[model samples]
Every structure is written in structure tokens, then in C-alpha cells.
Target: MAGPGGRMMAGGGPGQRSIDFKGSSKRLIARFRPERATICALLACVVLSVGLSVIGPKILGRATDLVFAGIVGRDMPEGATKEQVLESMRERGDGEVADMLRGTDFTPGEGIDFTAVGDVLLFALGVFLVAGLLMAVATRLVNRAVNHTMFRMREDVQTKLSRLPLSYFDKRQRGEVLSRATNDIDNIGQTLQQSMGQLINSLLTIIGVLAMMFYVSWILALVALVTVPLSFVVATRVGKRSQPHFVQQWRSTGTLNAHIEEMYTGHTLVKVFGRQEESAKRFAEENEALYEAGFKAQFNSGVMQPLMFFVSNLNYVLVAVVGGLRVASGSLSIGDVQAFIQYSRQFSMPLTQVASMANLVQSGVASAERVFELLDAEEQEADASPAERPDEPRGRVALERVSFRYDPEKPLIEDLSLAVEPGHTVAIVGPTGAGKTTLVNLLMRFYEVSGGRITLDGVDIARMSRDELRSGIGMVLQDTWLFGGTIAENIAYGAAREVTREEIEEAARAAHADRFIRTLPDGYDTVIDDDGSGVSAGEKQLITIARAFLSDPVILVLDEATSSVDTRTEVLIQKAMAQLAHGRTSFVIAHRLSTIRDADTILVMENGSIVEQGAHTELLAADGAYARLYKAQFAQAVAEVD
Candidate 1:
């Protein structure tokens, strides 16, 4: 049940544990299976584009050799023709090179063929243009696929959240859950959109460039290949070492965000306690930890590019030095040597990209793991198959030797039995932490009973679907919740069917909320903020009462329903409650002894067991736990009045 923040450092910022990269990556890859056709097409474009890029340097090298051949032929003696010069050049054992140089215009006195050179330059430019176009198309296709895939992933995560049980949220911070939903998903989307295509293109370029380099000159290819292992060694080592830091960085970010959210939401409380300095100190500590983690992660990732660049430059030097010797010995042409140098440089470019992208991939995988964790969390039990449905349910209820506990080691309720006839008000009074609310929770099926059974009208509540059982009961809690919407909409929130404006107004009047609501400028149409900030606590409570009234439930449960109101408002709310409970079964959990004096039966609870049960006069005569509680409250009220 411990959330991400609990796993973080004590008195510091957040930290995270490592996850299984292989499993997460496999799941992430499976998300795109539906887009296989688009991926295949993207791959085709990549191959076409990389093929053109790989061949361009070699074709341009042919032009360089052509220019060289023309210069050599132009310097030939007057008696010797250009063809004779070419025959001598062919004897140097470059037959393929000689064939490529054929049909080029060259004269004994002329320096070179400008027209032929222009044609070769134009052909190279055309190849580059075609490759650029293919690259553009491939980029567009990748974006489409990435965005669609992300859309589906987000939808799945959202759906999963709804299916998760209330218990899952009880142990986690709101900010932590939101961070996974927003920040983690965004990271996954960005990595896939920006880095995925680059990863594919870099890999293809590396393969194609390597093949071309080997074809041009195996010796130079071998020299360049040496950097491959060195690059991998540096990247793999640095990447693995930096990954934990990146995970820590993200976890710290989520923790810091959660802290900020809590502080902001409770700013009034912090100020009231004059704890500003303490809050700032805590924030600074967390911020410092985040800074440290981020610095280490970025620094480690940054080292890869420069080191790979150095390796590439060193390989280029070796290729140049070696190829020059071959050219000088007439074993290789100037054009061939130039082409080999380009290929050597191209080979390392993709390796450098892959190294640079390695850190981002690691961060992305970390995010994916968190997202997958949420999706894989335990969900609420499914509704009973062919679930029972009761027709026109009566309000009679019973608990048969029920035992319950929040923590199994510490027993709360044990061997308790109770029964209530239809249309009777049963008041439950208890000290703090006496399991009053826990009993209500069990009855509502919020938490299943650890032992025994609770029933409504002899039908086991467990056999009925949660929705079916809950539909007949209305709950007005001490903490009232109102969403951002019109006041009328809030009041009619849980109605089984559409409620008329007249019905809404009637319910509001019955809850004593109509007078105050009418004072607002928009009246029932007034828009409330998310926290019902504009309304007072008493008013918020009234609205919740009105919501319950609108539902017209068969049974009502009010947990300290009048706790927040002033004395005058409390009296009015009491009257409203009297009218609402006249003919319906109601369970009232109240701390105010005077409020429940007229209850048909009063149950005095302590710890988790009912210690006293009787009418008010009978309980007082017994001089037991209920008598002591009523006397204590009466004395307290008298002291307050004096």
C-alpha cells in the first residue's frame, strides 16, 4: 500500500526502484501491433531514403575520378591522343574505374570537361533531393502512428483507473496518481514521437553505411569497425550507470509535485500554524535532491556524444592516412579514396546518434514501467454473476454476529447482532475511533465484513449487486462534496431519473437550503467551484441533504449531518431531518446527545461493540455507558453556554 513517496528517501527528495526493462518494453511494443502495416510502410521509406544516402558518396566519387581523368588526358603530348592516356590509366588496374570514366569529353590541350562535371553534380543533387523527400514522408507517417498509439494508451490508462478499487486510492497521494497519468504518459508519448523514428533511421543508416564501406575498401572498413565496440562499451556502461539516476529524477519530480499540491491545498492551515519556515525547509531539501539526481543523469548522458565524436574523428584520420597510401601506389583512385572517407564518417554518425538517444530511451522505459504498474494493479471484484435484484425493497435490516476490522490484527467489531424494523430511526452514539463510521461502511458494502452477514429484509445484502443495494440507501456524510457545476445540478446529482426543476426546489426547501440559495445572484443556477469554495460549510451540508432528499431513498444514513452548522441552522436542519425521516428507516450517527433524544432506540457503542441499547429514559435509568456519555455532553454544553 506504500506509494512512491514512501519508497523515497527520508527527509530528502523522492527515489525509485528499478523495474524490468525487458518486460515493459515487450508490453510497449505490443501496443503498436495494430499499426503493423503503417510501421512496415515507414520501414520501406527508411530503406529507400538510406539507400540513396549510402550510394550518393560513391556516385560523387565517380565524378571526382572523371575530373581527374580529364586533367590527366589534357596534359598528354600532341602525338599521343586522350584514348592512349586512358589506356595507360586502365593498366593501373582500375578497370571498373576506367569504365566509369568512359564517354567523358577530354582533349589533349583542354584542362577538363566542365559540361560532364556539371551533369554529375546534377545527378548527385537529384539523388539527395529524392532522399530528402522520402525522409519527409517517412517522418509524417511515423508521427501519425505514434500519436494514434499514444491515444490508445492514454485511453487504456484512464479506463483502468476507473476500475480500480477505492482501497487503491486510499493508500496513494492524489498528486502521485495524477503524475503517473499526466507526466509519465507524456514522457512515453514524446519519446515515441521524437526518438522512435530517429532510432530506426540511425540503425538503418549504420547497417547500410557499413555495407557500403566494406564494399569500397575492406581494410578501411576494418579500421572503422574498431570504434563500434569501443562506442558500445562506453555507451552501455554509462547508460546503465545513469539509468537509476534518471529513475530517481522522475520519482523525485512526482514527490515534489505531490508536496506542492498538498501545501497549496492547505495553505491556510500552514499559515495558521506559522509553519512557513518549516514548509520552505522541507521543500528546499526535496528540491536539492531532485537537482542532484537530474544533474547526475544529464551529465552522464551528455558524456556519450563527445566520446563517440572523438572515436569517429580518430577513425576518419586512420581511413584518410591509409587510403592516401593506396591512392599514391596507384592501387586506388582519388575518387575511391574520397568515397571511402565519406563512408567511414557516415558509419560512425548513426553510432553516435544511437548513443545519444540511449539515455532518452532509458528514461522512456522507466516511465513505461510506472504506467504499466498502474494498469496491472488489482481491481475491484466483479459484480455477482446474474446478480440478485429485489422488487420494492423494504427498509428492515439486521446484522447477525458481525465482526469487522480495518487491520485484521486489531479487532474492532466482534459478535455484534442487531435488528431494526421498517420505518424506525436507530441512533448510534460513540466516542472517537469507536467504529461508528466503520459500521456504516460495512452496511454500505464499502468494505466487506471480515465475518458474519448483514441483511436487508432477510435477503443477504452480499447476494445483491452493489449498485442495487446502494440505490435504495442515501448517505449524507460529515464532509460534503460538491463538484464544479450549477447548484441545481449538484442537488440532483444521484437521481435515478431526470428530476424536474419543481422537484429540485421542493427538495431544497425541505433541506432548508432554498432560502440561502435564493440569495445568490444566479440562485439555483449558481455555478459552484470544484471545492464549493464560495459556499459556507453549513450551506454545503444543506446542499448534500437536498441531494439525498432528491433521491428519495428507502433508507437514509446521516453521519453527524448537523455538525458544521450554527445553532439556528442546526435547528432548521433538525426539522428538515425530522420531516425526511418520518416514514423512512434512518441510521443516525451523532455526537450531540440532545439531537438523538427522541430516537425509537439508541445504541451506545464503545471500541467496536454495542455496550448499551434502549430508549433515552431507560438508558439513563440503567446508569451505564450511555448514561455517562449523555451526562458528559450535557455538562459540556452547559459550560459552553455559561
Candidate 2:
């Protein structure tokens, strides 16, 4: 849904949106398929580890019984059978002690057997030690599998982004998309790392401990089972309630990040327009929204732990009381009752742990959904198979009744027909919202033409692969983009193959960037960031021109390429561009009329139509739209000069 400022909100909006928990969690698990072997090993470790851990309490019970039986036997007289001593005790009206003693196996007059107790204790310790070792191994395996899955997911996202159409990015904030790729993915990884192994172990432990509990005493086991349903209900209800908040939390994060990115990037603009307070207010609003979403998510999920703990304590008390009565009746031994109590605790601990992890799982799945949404996004149309190319590879391009619209209902470029001969310079000039750049965009197939076919040397461009079409063209856009690299590397970026230092320098010289580069601290080797921080706007423009120069493409496009440069540099660029355009088809979209007075052809565009077309002198003599634009610009220049 669209929100204020046309920002998209998948889950964070005025009304909270429910998450597809089951589907998203299943998809997240499916991502680990490539690590199937590791997962299987981890499961093996967990199963064996849990088996040993469950048996440890039973073995410890034997040790307890040995010590306890010795204490009971030590109080009895020698030379009498175990039944005789118990019968005498009952006769003396010590019936409770006698009943409890009937379950013990010990020699009369024997004291606590330290040796037997030590041996049993050692066995129990060994069982637990091995279990702990196996659990550690399982943890390592889980980490490996989770990390591998996350690595592949990142790769998939990166590959997916490259296939998405320009329009997809045009409509979305860069930061919003970036959050999916970085923050959301990272959150998922962290959650999985923290929860996946433990969740598996907790589940297995519950099953194992439940079995042990039933083995010790079925009655106590039944008592422990009473609270199981309650724990599950608590977990599910709290999880469901908190899930939407988790979804909103991540959505708010993306929105806040998008706002911050926009504000930071345009901080100078905000200050220039004296809108600092407005920007700050907007930030506070987004920040507050994120805080609320996060708080609610945590609070709701947070309630699960204490509630589960309460249910577990209730189960514990019930088992303890019931086991005591069974021991008193001689139905179960004291050691057996003790072991049953331990089993009950083990069972409840997993339940409590899983309940506590409800929020973490919800949060992780929320992030996974965001990433899956990106992966599921519609991609650009596939490239043509058995692609066609221009036979002669000349720089001739023609738009035959081409039409296009960003919105299907609103046309931007309609029936725009034009043909450029090999090596001719065509200059496009128009007011804002004119179809000037849109024409170049179609010619390059940045956008598919809606109504008619655009062709290169008579072969329809749509029939060719985008890479094949773009490889033949070099463009210097009005808004320059420079990756963080040396100046030489930036210039060489236009070339398809590796370029030499001398060649890079020669291209820079042609674009009039070499002089300023040499004046910088590290000359051509100086590195700038993505935003071209170290270079002036004109210098950035010059570097882009240099990049285009290095490509030496058959077709060239300059979209206000010299708009930032001073008049002196513009004259130098014009001279260099003339030499560059000597035998290549060139398309220049210029706002400055003086720059294209000598072009072979001039087009005046307005509202998606070519209103006038001629040579500069011809159009000026005809006194058409082109003449008026030129005259207006000339008067403006005169006024500025005065």
C-alpha cells in the first residue's frame, strides 16, 4: 500500500498487517536444502545427545537409591530378611517408613555404600559429558548450515537486483531496497543462529524427557502432561498476537532507513530550503513509529516466557506431589520419584524455552518474508533468444512511429519518429517534461517502445539482447555517477576490456579532465567515493565524459553533459566532442542552445511530439518553436551578461 509521500508500506501502515508466518518460515527452512548433509549430521548429533542426556537422570537415580538404601539398611538389625524387618517396622506402627523401605533394595545393617554410589555417579557424569560434547558438535553444524544458507540468499538477492527493470528502482527508494538486502537479511541470519539449533534441541529434549518420565512412573507422566496443552496454547496465542508487530517492526525499519538516506543525501538541499526542522520532525516521526512497533513486538512476545514458566512450575508442583504419594504407597521408589521429577523438569524446560523463542522466530520469519518478497518481485522481460544484430554495425538508428508512457494511461512519447544517418549529429532540445531524454531512452531500449518498433540498421532493437545493443553506445548522463576508485579506473570503466594507463590518460586529456586530475593530491591515482566527494561537479562531469571517450563506441549520447562546466571548459569540450563525433552517430540532449548551433540536425520536442525539425539556421529562419527557444535563451544570456 502507498503511504504519505508515496512511500510503499508492505506491513507498516495505519493499520497493522498480519504476517504469513507458516509460509515464510517454511520458505526460510527450504533455503537450507543445499546444506542437507550438514543438517542431517546435526540431527544425528542432537538425537544421540538427547538420548544420553535423558538417560543421565535415570542413572543418577540409581546412585541416589544406593546411598538412600544404605541409610535405611544401616538402621535395621542384621540376620533378618528384608520382609521381616519391614514387617516388624509395620508392627511397631512405623508403617510409613516401612512402606517406603519396601521399595529399597539393600542388605540389613549395611551402611551407605560409597563405592557403588561413586561408580553410578561416574557413569552418570560420563553420560552427560558425552551429551554435552555431541550438543557442541550439533551447534557447530547448525551454524555452518545457517551461514551457508545466508550466503546463498545474499547472492540470490544481488543477482535478482541486476535483473530487475530500471522502473522498479525508479519507483522505490534505494534505502528501502538496501534494507532488504542488508538489514533484513542480517536479522534473519542472527535469529537463525540464535534459535535454529536450540529449537531443534529443545524439541528433541521434550520428546526424550517425556519418554523417560513415562518410564519412571506413568501416573506422574500423566500429571506432567496436564500442563502441556496450556503451555502450547500460551505459546501459540502470544506468537500470533505478536507476529503482526514483528512485521510492522521491519517495515518501519525500512521506512526509517529510506527517510534517513534521502535526508542525508539531500542534507544541503534541506538546509538551503531552510527545512531542517521539517526534516527533523519527519525523522522523529519515523523513529517513533519504529520504536512503537518494536516495543509492541517485544512486549507481546516477552509475555510468553513468564507464562510458560508459570505453567512449568505448576506442572512441577503437580508431579512432585503425585510422585511423593506414589512413593509413600510403595507404588514407586523414592529414587524413581526423584528421577520422574527431573524428567518433568526437563520436559517443561524445553516448553519454556520454545515459548521464549516465539518472538525470535516471528521476527526472523518477518525478515525472511521481506527478502522473499524481493526475490519474488517481477523482473524485466527476458532477452530475445537467437538475438539479431545490425548486419553492417553502422551507427544508424531509427525510431519508426515509436510511442511510450511511464503510466499506461498517460503517454509521454507518442509517435516519435526520427532517423539518424551514420555519423550524423542530432541534437534534441525541449522544455521540461518534453520527450527529449525519453527518445534516447527508447533508442537505447532503456524502455521498450509502446506502439512501434525501433530499429538499428533496419534490425529491430527489441530483437537484440540489451547487452549487445548497449555495448555499441556510450552515454554521459547529466547526473554523473562515480564508483569509489582511482580517477584512472573511473575513466577506464567505460571500456569493455582492460585499459592501459596511457590510454586512460589520453581519454582524460580529451575530456579536459587530465589537467585538474594532475593538480589533485594523487593525480590519476587519487580515489574518490561513490558520490564523487573530492571532485567538483564540473570535474565529475569531465570524468564521465572521459569514461565515454574511453569506450570509443559507434554511437554516443550526451545528456546535458556540459551543463556543469564553465563556458571556457564547454568550448574545449565542444571542440573535443566534434573530433569524437567525426565518424560516430551522436545524440545530444542540451538545454544550452548555443552548444548545438552547429549540429547537422536539430529537433524541438514538446509534449511527446517533435514540433519542429531542421538545421539550426533553417529553424531560426523559419521562426518556429526551435527559433523561439533559441531566441529566449540568447536574451537570457544577454541579460545575465549585462
Q: Which pairs clash in the backbone of model 1? A: none
Q: In model 2, where do residues sit more than 4 Å from their true spots?
A: 1-14
Residues 1-642, model 1: lDDT tens digits: 223554324233223566577788899989999899999999999999999999999999988977987786677665667577568678988665455445444566666677888898899999999999999999998998989998998999899998787678888888878888999989998988878889889999989998998898888788878777888898888887788877787777777778888898788899999989999978976776677778778888889889999988988988999887777665677888889999988888888888888778878888898889899999877777887765667798899999998777999999989999888999999899898988998888887888999999887888888888899999999998899999999999959999999999999999999999999989999999868878998999999999999998988999998898888988888888888887788999999988898889999899999999989999999999998998998899899999
Note the Cα lDDT for every prediction shown: 0.86, 0.91
Q: Candidate 2, after superposition: displacement of residue 636 in Å?
A: 1.3
Give the TM-score (vs. native) of candidate 1: 0.90
Q: Tens digits of per-residue lDDT for model 2 on 1-642?
A: 444665433344525667788999889998899999999999999999999999998998898899889988898898888999989988999999888778989889889999989999998989999999999999999899999999999999999998998889999999899999999999999999999999999999999998888888777888999998898799889988888889999999999899999999888899999999999978877887787778889999999999998998999899989888988888888888888888988999999988888888899999999999999999988889999988888898888898899999998988778899999999999999998888888877777888998888888989999999999999999999999988899899999999999999999999988999999999999999988998999999999999999999999999999999999999999999999998999999999999999899999999999999989999999998988898899999899999
Q: Please count the clashing residue pairs in each candidate, in the order shown.
A: 0, 0
lDDT leader = 2
Model 1 clash count equals 0
The whole-model C-alpha lDDT of candidate 2 against the native structure comes to 0.91
